[model samples]
Target: MKKLLKYSAFGLGGLVGLMLIVVAIVAATFNPNDYKQQIIDLVQAKKSRTLKLDGDIKLAFWPKIGANLGKVSLSEHKGSAEFAAVDSVKVSLALLPLLKKELIVDTVYVDGVRANIVKYKDGTTNFDDLLSKDEEESQTIKFDIDGVNVTNSAANYSDEGTGAKYSISKLNLKSGHVALAEPIDLETDFTVTANQPAVAANAKLKGNFLVDPATKHFVAKGLDASIKGDLLGGKDVDITASGDIDAKPDTKEFLINSLKLAATGQFSGAKLTIDLSAPELKALKDEVTSKEAKVSLVQEKGSDTFKANLVLADIKGSPKALQSSGITGDISGVQGKRTISGKFSSPFIGNLENLIFDLPKLAGNLDIKDPALPNGGVKGNFNLTLHADAKQELVDSKFDLKVDSTQLNGDVAVASFTKPNIKFNLNADTLDLNKLLGTSSAANPAEKTAANQKPADLSALKNLLLDGKIKIGNLIYQKYRLSGLNVGIKADGTKLALTGLNVKLDDSQIKGNLAISQFAKPLYTFDIDIDRLDVDRYVTANTGATPAATKTSDKPLDLSALKALNADGSLRIGSLKYGKTKASNIRIDLKADGQKLSLNPLAAKVDDSQINASIGISRFSDPIYSFNVNIDKLDADKYITKSDPNSKSPAAKSTGDTPIDLSALKKLNASGEAKIGWLKLANVKTENVSIGLKAADGIATVSPFSANLYQGNMS
Candidate 1:
């Protein structure tokens, strides 16, 4: 028995030695380089491309059954440019595994591989022929690869039609146990450049993947990726993401499970950071559905910080259909520690080509700081609701804000944008108009003129309507303090009306209504009533110009504004104080049309005397004015005497004659009549006086100008 075992062992050893000798003989005799021409000829006949092997090809035995190829290249069809090239490639197989028909490869190592692919406008690529397969060929062979490692590889693709170029460089890839139907582990790092969108980036990916070769279904687990690049027009961005992905190529359905991504970038000199996570997301073609997602963003620049959080759910469809799909989300943010929260939705989404917003409903609460206030800040809390229907061309919004000692409520609606039917109501406890104006005084003439200049192309006001009401408890405008101010206004295309405007000033109350028509050539009509007005005070407060005693210029006054104006207005004052003059129950009616203007029946009571006057002006360039005056019981001595009763009258002194320019009279055409019941001046008393005056073409005449002096009539 021992001898028989020994002979069997020797036979086994001899068999092993014969196998090694055979392997050695095959390795030494086989010239892989000699087959290079055959491989080139076979590839050329099959792929219609030229193949070149510039370096040696060698085979190895004993430890592993392997082959190493050096410097191989394939040329573009009918072109001298190389389509793909490789510096070296080494493939190894376990001899025992091969003997067992398992065909286990130790490693497939590919180094310095490069490919330049181009797609032309004719829908043909440089590698099209190489990638095409004959229909008659049967795919009956199947094999498994234990591992593959690729290093220092690059691929470039260019589309001639789109002028787009993309390249991947310094690519390194590693895969383990790749099979037709089994799971595989993969890791890759590459640098990419894209010309169409203009991006440059370095990316790394690590994942475990299961792929079904038949149905082309793929599932990825524990996938992580990172990219660093300059994106979005040269902004430096770094992003990292991890997720599980599943895809079915047949159904075109893809899903991501537990996706978490974080990014940091700089945009427009502001640092931005974003964090996003989703439990599950699914998509098919243009339709996308996602579960609740948590998203956070923070932006900071200098001392300003803004942070926001968003939770989204049930998101589906393309951007255009998203409006109709009705998205629901909660958004909250803090700007410098000012918290704001809102529920956002879009029930009826419309196409962006014709709509302002896909989902325009926003209802939010804000606790914010108002930096425009005088204090450190005006702390305010407000509830705002806004809604818009771009299809209907309407907007409706309302807000109620309360800050410190002030509260405001406003509701506004715009029925249409094209033909703008608008309505608004506003109420405020107190508002400092000066504060809102923010130190901006009245603009200079140049700015005002620029602002008032008519547009080169005017759009017609068609079907315009507006009705608004505003009320404020107190308003501080300029240097004037006012209270209980209310304004009601209505406007249409052709006319605008201010129905009720009331305000309380200092110790007086003002009430007025105004109407304007003929927008093309505006005409104004107003009726204003004031309990008492201090003209000097208002003039001093509003304008720096004060009344000065100076010689009147002979140059004609520029009444172009009046000539351009078309207006009819009436003003009434219970009492008015202008400088040292006091008047009561003053009423004036004014009218102007083109170059003609009339102030008829201007009546006032001054110092217990009643005065009535009528004035007319024509020819605006060099205006001619006609006036008729009537007075009853005027105490002239009071006005003519000096303020100091003890002061003596100075002796008369000769003064140069101030010649009056009658050039304006040439443009005048005026006629008037006047009468006085009683008049007293310097101890002279006159009663029952009448006068008639006419001026035209530089001629002036007074006819039947008579007065009863000391009870005697004189003419």
Candidate 2:
């Protein structure tokens, strides 16, 4: 028609130029290392398994597309599978028209892939049963992405029920896939290494994965994580956190739905938020170590409630009982969800060897609830009032707690508990007894130089702080001491009760009542009552004595009591006016057992002697006697042969009785028995010339023995 349209366009341009030279001679023999062994035999024939390649399997792509096996081996049944680094894999064929699949994966660049995921301890797995079954269904595929890199991956974990094994080494990850032909999108980066060190350094974690191909259900966003280390012993921590997670699509057992958490960020940022619908898990994160929980925690075993607003910054892989320890803020009431509240705002700095004690920089608001965990949980309760300051190791106390509660039942050890706990009201107030005797100054400074030096080597025995204040009533820390100590002083073993047990070196005050019923057969009881509140600076710092006057015993003395409450000795308070001696109106009703003291008939008008006594103080020469005295009246020859003389009685030993000096009878034993009644009779006292002598310091005058003298035996 126009020469047949120019020979039909030159015979179709010579048949399209001979079909582009026969496709450039089949793309020039198409040999790019034979298409990289046809992509390693098409990924070993769709993973029929077996694939090993170390370099040389490359196809720089441009016509050869992509292929770089580099270092590879994919067996997977549980072991023998190493990609060790692929970094380049871009196979191609499907360019998407409508939906076609010639097995195309336009991109796959893996880097340093060293994956070792095991599951033994009996769970058995080396990837057991390696991926199978995929009857072809690429609802449209033609990927396009180039990103994959992982390094130093190590993950080891075992769990033969409870033997538990752990390991997770340096891992750095990066994954990618999203050239979106649809249905395959991924991007990940994970780096976590603990115990294997590096600990992510002050750490910052990120996690967010979404999957909902209709309902595979997995929508995690802003995932959070936190960690710090060494807190209990104190020092160095910068913790942080962030959160949001989900898992619950019908349960394969990954039930943790939507949560929110937060934490500051100046080194380690921190935050924690938990959701409930929980049925179980929390022994820190129950994978189960078994103390036999969940019956509600074992049927209301008690204690667990806590309110928090924490500030944990220096946190890192803890669990050596919380390495060094940590506790910061928010507590109004807490009983059992376990809240030991510390880092020390006031547990009286509870000497854990007192490094510096911290943790209670609290912001109040706490609650505890325990007693509901025999199986279903919620049986933990505890309430605590907060206010703590005082540290030299710790003192300056104030604790007020009410308890129809007690539950730290991860089964005990917080100082030991066997259950059966109750304290309707517990109150520990202002106790700075020199930091419980550790030489307080808030201790610290190495416990103030080890409470003032002295520890080159001493095994065991470290707790010692005889401070004060303890007004308990039921008393039962091993038995006894209920009614005896009036209500305090449990003694060296501790129950303590002091109105003012001062000790600033001198100004001491102590009213007595000390008891111990059992500390391995211990029964030291006392009803001691002393005055002169500061008795000559406590007898010049205990027994250097030397005070007969200075109006010093520091006043407060006014003795007039005699009621041993009944163990014998019913009534005998006839003037015990001490200091300047005044045994005066002495009346006695005694019943002493063992060394014997039977003053069943004792009446006295001392010094002027209208005394009637009967005392027997045997042995040691025998004459500390105050046994018979019916002194109806006595001058005792000017009171024992002119008063004053060692009362000279050592002469008679022709087996007749009279030869004292047991240090003159252990220095006249005194109201504490050794001798003393009948107004002292040593030189002579039968009533003045009628004789009356009180041996040198003990006084004893009995000449011709006063006619009123009754029944006696002295020594």
Candidate 3:
């Protein structure tokens, strides 16, 4: 029995040796290059593409059954450009496993592989034919691979429709065992260039994956990726991301769990950093949801830090209908301990047939404090609520705000986005207009420079509409001080109106109403009343310039603004003091229409006398004026006396002939009539005086000039 066993073992050994010898003979004697033509012909017949083998094909039999090919290329069907090319490809297979119907590949090494892909304007790709197959040729093929390694590969893609080109170079990929149900490890590094944006990026990825080939299910864990690039022309960016992903093909569900990302970049010469983390994010065929997310951002140049928390409920809809989807979410943010919370909801999410976006509720509250404010800082809080009607129109909105010593409560409605109807009442204890103008020194240099620059456009204000009432207890505007100021204002496309305007200035009260229209030519109308006014003091206080006592030179007045003015107004002053004139119970009605202006009557009581006058001017280019005056009981002695009571008038002094400037008289044509009831100079008195005067073409004439003086008549 022992002898028989030994002989049998020897036979088995001989059989194994013979098989090895046969493999060796095949590896050495067989030339795979001999069948290259046949292989190329077969590929051309099947795929309708040209194949080229520039180098040689070789086989190996020692550790594994393998094949190596060199310098292989495949041509595009109708173009001279090669579709794919490779410098070398080495494939090895486990010989014994194939007999048992198990494909156990030892390793696959590919080097210097290059591909060029193109998309035509008609949405067809160069590889479209390669991806399509007949029904009979469509069959599932399965295989297992132990490992794969690729190096120095490149791919280029271009889209004619979008005019975008992309290139990938120095691509290296490594993978562990891949099977139908087992986990695999993968790592990749590549550099990508995009022509459309003209940017370049270097990226790396490492992860472990579990894939089910039959079901097309995939899950990835310990996934990490990083990219560094120059974006947006010249901004340097570095981004890192880590996450776990799970996907189900049958249900069309995808979930990302425990995702974290960080980014740092230089934008507009500022260093910016951002960090983000999310607990879970999920997307189904109909809905996308997120549990919680947190984000933090910092800017080095601005010294600003922001943090936010966000939560989203089930949100589902098509892209255009997303606004109507029944989405519920809340977002909160913090900046230096100041907090703001906003919540939003809609009622049309799941209803596919609804096209209207009915926003059922939107509410928010904000509290802010910033050190850059004019008064060191500003503290404020406000609440806002909005609701949309069934037709998806925003109808009723309410706002309540309290900032510093100011309080505003308002309700608003809108017919459309272009027009709004508002009812609001605003009250402020004190508001410094200068402060609100952002005249503080703490403003950024760049921002200040931008503010000082002239704006290129003012077209946005062409469609503005404002209607509101504002009141302030104490206000300081530039050089003016005002108290208990209230104004109701309305503005639309054609006109602006201000009513019920009352303000106290310089211990006096003023009330007025004004209207301005811009439909065609600019026009203005005003009605003003004043209890008392010190014109000189008020003017000096507001203008910061002292009035000159005497004219030093004669210069032409710029009446261009007045030439464009079209105004009609009335002024009533109880008492007015201007320069050396003191007047009481004054009333003036004035009108200006283009280049023509008229003062129908200017009446005032001075001391124990009353005076009335009327004036008119026309021909703006060469003004012509006419005036009429009436005086009752005027004391002429007071006007003739010197301003200094102690000093006497100097004796009459005569010099050489002084030429009169008749040039002014040539421009002016005047005609008037005057009447005086009484006039007295020292002891001489005259009454019942009437005069008529006319001057034109440098000529003066008087008619029916008569006066009763010293109980006698003179003409």
> Which one is best on TM-score?
1
RMSD of each: 17.5, 24.6, 15.5
* Per-model lDDT: 0.77, 0.37, 0.72
Displacement of the residue 70 alpha carbon in candidate 3, Å: 1.4
The full ranking of all candidates by lDDT, starting with the best, is 1, 3, 2
| Best model number under lDDT | 1
Which portions of model 1 show Cα errors greater than 4 Å? Answer: 1-373, 376-381, 390-394, 402-405, 440-463, 541-552, 641-671, 695-700
> Which portions of model 2 show Cα errors greater than 4 Å?
1-30, 33-64, 68-90, 93-177, 180-191, 194-257, 260-715
- What's each prediction's TM-score? 0.48, 0.24, 0.47
Residue 477's C-alpha lDDT in candidate 1? 70
CA lDDT, candidate 3, residue 222: 90
Sort by TM-score, top down from the best: 1, 3, 2
Candidate 2, 639: how far from true, in Å?
42
The CA-based lDDT of model 1 is what?
Answer: 0.77
- Summarize candidate 2's per-residue lDDT along 247-350 as a digit string, tens digits: 44443223243333322222222222222222222222213111111111011112433333333222222111122233333333344343333221212122
